[model samples]
Target: MLKTMHRPFHVSPWHLTLACGLFKLLLAAAAFALPLSQVDDLPRLVGLLLLAGGFSELLLSWTGRHSWVGRITFGSGALTVVLGALFIGGPWKGLYPLGPFVTVWFLLRALLSIDVAFQSRLTPMANWIWLLLRGFVDLALGLLLLAGAPLAMLAIVVFGEVREFVTLFSATLAVSFAIAGGGLVAIALTQRHYHRSDPFMIAS
Candidate 1:
């Protein structure tokens, strides 16, 4: 009975994957829920998404904190939470403040994704190639955002509207979130299936 109870307490990589997937889905929903026309809401939307992600990571880290990865995740979560709060409370307005901020965020996550995809090659993680592809997509999205920032500013100077720029960022985020969320969920399910079939085949 004690061993049976203890078994459930053991944390696995799939748990982290699932949590991240769910968080990303939440981001997608939030991004879609906010009308892109209300450009003022962009920063707030990003803040909420970051807060959700930070809390998810923090909770998962608490469960798996004996490992080095967990410690790193905890630190990241704390920093993310801080940043999220700042974004929410700050007096930022328009693309001038948000474009560069989100661009940097996407680029950092892209690098992390690519690194993790490579690391997973040593493990039996499912759809690792998809992960690699997602990383590339993220990288591309980040680059696009970076390039679009100046163009967006120019649009404001010429056309007096930044709707195209806003739409581009919003659409990119929604699509990226959906793709990453779906892939991570699939990978988690595959890992779960493999674990059931061979209890000792994969390490937690």
Candidate 2:
């Protein structure tokens, strides 16, 4: 009397990726919605929020598409997670946190642009130049933050140094979250379509 074994359900990568993307977007919303700025330990509170965002990013990386695109995505996510951990442990407080956070965001975004480029290649006559250009720009921004000179100048021009550059940093985070979230969802949909068409493609 042999018993049949039941296999546990496995989540599709696209599903998990979209969920993580949505969660990341929500983290940005939470960061903005909460009035933690007025509190005494802004760094600790903000650090916690960033930690949550980082965790989602790590999860996204884990569930992202399986390819070189995914590898770069994972590296980007891991780097941001490390920065969040550093912020929580000590240092990376106040204005110092902004640079690393923004830089990491741009770097992650650049990797995502690579993913977009990879996807575009599958389409006919795809204008991958746009995606590559965006990736270059994002990479430049991250490098500039490391340079410290240009980022400061850009920050001053965009949001000014007043009010601790809070507006500037938050805006950066917001844009990163928004773009990544939307892109991940769109990519997930595309992947789903591809999966659905696989059998037909094979038969053809």
Highest lDDT scorer: 1
Reference-based TM-score, model 1: 0.76
lDDT of 1 by residue, 71-148 (tens): 645765665676678678989875457667667766766776676566555445446676677778878998988877
Clash pairs detected, candidate 2: none
Runs in model 2 deviating more than 4 A are: 1-12, 33-36, 63-66, 97-101, 108-112, 115-120, 123-164, 195-204
Cα error, residue 28 of model 2, in Å, equals 2.4
Root-mean-square deviation (CA) per prediction: 5.8, 8.5
**TM of each candidate vs. truth:** 0.76, 0.64
Give all candidates' CA lDDT scores: 0.66, 0.57
